[model samples]
Target: MNIDPQKPLLQLNVGEFLDLLKNSATEKKYEYGLKGLAKMLGCSRSKASVIKSTGILDEAIVQNGNLIIIDKDKALQLLAQNKK
Candidate 1:
């Protein structure tokens, strides 16, 4: 690549920059905390906690200190399998 002092090195409009950001990033596919899980599951927070305690979602659950995050798709799949 040759350096060009007379010409602009790069050019991007705001919309193009935003689109690039959107396409370049991977979105998180998990839910945070029991409340988030409840919202995703369409259940009460207490119910989500109960489900967490059952260990049925163990494979989908991630715990860091007191914070809990659940992989939404995996949890739903596990629940569906459990129902069968």
Candidate 2:
């Protein structure tokens, strides 16, 4: 994954995002926090939050009393399905 610093990260469609995550996972871990997920999806935190609020995505885990985590693969699938 060679990302050129001078260029913008490609805004991936849902399928591409899922494939990228599948190829990048180690030990099958594909979860990310809201901030990290926004980065992965090439969107802002508020946008991600809105998407989540619309029931297109859900928290995959919650830990340490306040941390919320999402499954990237699942979110991508839901987003893709929602578009259909």
Candidate 3:
């Protein structure tokens, strides 16, 4: 049996990962925490720290807990405007 080396060697590229993250953020239906968002965004909890520091995504307060997800409207607006 031949094994495919490319399998598992191909993690989604940053742009692809970011696009997925944006889409997921746009579809959020419940409260999520920073760690949760980090996990969902394909970043290790450590990497999430870096991403948040970079401000591509931000933390928001929801009710009594913390929610961490991208701003869907802002992301779509930016994508829309940059297309021109």
Candidate 4:
């Protein structure tokens, strides 16, 4: 990494910094288990299981044995892409 002292770094006010943090935190929410996934998708557990089996959201899914975790934003994006 090269440091360029001549270039000033970006600055943010306290409110702007807080807003950025809040947006970042909301942007990458994780949902755990089938119930959580269903809640995230606004669908039933059965439908969520079916969607999981389709493998369309595989990139957003993390599984270990019986445990499942989903990246809500990524899954929603994938679903939106597939809706087209």
**TM-score between candidate 3 and the true structure:** 0.35
Rank the models by lDDT, top first. 1, 4, 2, 3
* lDDT string, candidate 2, 1-84, tens digits: 543345534766566667668877886446556687677678999986776677667544443645767666777777788894
* lDDT (Cα, tens digit) per residue for candidate 1, span 20-74: 6677698779999999999998999999899899999999999998899899889
lDDT tens readout by residue for model 3, 17-54: 66656765745543355576465556677875664565
Off by over 4 Å in 4: 1-28
lDDT of each: 0.84, 0.66, 0.51, 0.83
Best by lDDT: 1
- Name the better of 1 and 3 by lDDT: 1
lDDT of 2: 0.66
- Model 4: per-residue Cα lDDT over 1-84, one tens digit each: 233445444655566667666765744489999999999889999999998999899999999999998988899899999984
Candidate 1's error at 22, in angstroms?
Answer: 9.1
Each prediction's TM-score versus the true structure: 0.66, 0.53, 0.35, 0.66
Model 2 residue 44 distance off true place after TM-score fit, in angstroms: 0.8
Worst 10 residues of 3 by lDDT: 56-65
